[model samples]
Target: MIDLFKFFGKEESKSKDIAKERLKLVLIHDRANISPKFLDMIKDDIIKVISNYMEIEEAGLDIRLSRIPQEDDTYSTALVANIPIRRVKNMGPNRG
Candidate 1:
């Protein structure tokens, strides 16, 4: 049972979590002014391009674009993606 006496623990609270989460999100949004809808569009474009040339495992794909808070608490957003593809099976003239 949670101790009511320790209600004000030194741990992060739900409100704090919301603030931090919103802060990071707002920072990213404000820096680029890119809507979530636009982000989805970009993701689709990236997936299309990468899919055309390789049999990549979609679950392994990682794509993130965000800004880092600098000294002035202002920063630029950066796009980062990781697409891993396994080696092709066989294409040695069928060993003929």
Candidate 2:
């Protein structure tokens, strides 16, 4: 008779993989409180409003809604926008 207890190793790697997958999901949600759909809505609105004031390349704007973990619980959500400024026709170099 042969002992069949030394054929395969224990399942240690599988546990780590599962834990990593779960952490990724939780971090994604925590960073963005609102769903992906809602974040899209906000980005659109911000670009629209900003366009009215200046000549903004709407397609090039990047407005992301994220959360920041801090000591106190006052302000958690932060809105970050990346807008590139292009010199308009009239707003050229300063001339006399």
Candidate 3:
């Protein structure tokens, strides 16, 4: 027999996860004060810059704008980039 409670619980969990992700996107967009296209460009540039020194898990990379509370009761936008490093790259002496 199929367990209705378990099935509903799993569905509810999935819905909650989706809702949370949507809310995060909305918050980031509102707080960043930047267009989505610009954000994508920034994200790509960040990935490229980091990739020069180390290999990063592109799929695991999370770049978002967050609101940080300040002592003056004001909020500031911060760029948070969570780059998962797969391995460090070895860069030899630069011959310029």
- The lDDT values for all models are 0.74, 0.65, 0.87
In model 3, the Cα lDDT at residue 95 comes to: 27
For residues 1-45, write the lDDT of model 3, one tens digit per residue: 999999999999999999998887777787666877888999999
What's the lDDT for residue 82 in model 1?
84
True-structure RMSD, every candidate: 5.4, 9.7, 2.9
In Å, residue 80's CA in model 1 sits off its true spot by 1.4
Per-candidate TM equals 0.57, 0.48, 0.72
Cα-based lDDT at residue 79, candidate 3: 84
Which lDDT tens digits does candidate 1 get at residues 18-53?
899778877786678878788778888998876765
Candidates by lDDT, descending order: 3, 1, 2
Pairing residues by index, what is the TM-score of model 1? 0.57
Looking at model 1, residue 35 earns an lDDT score of 80
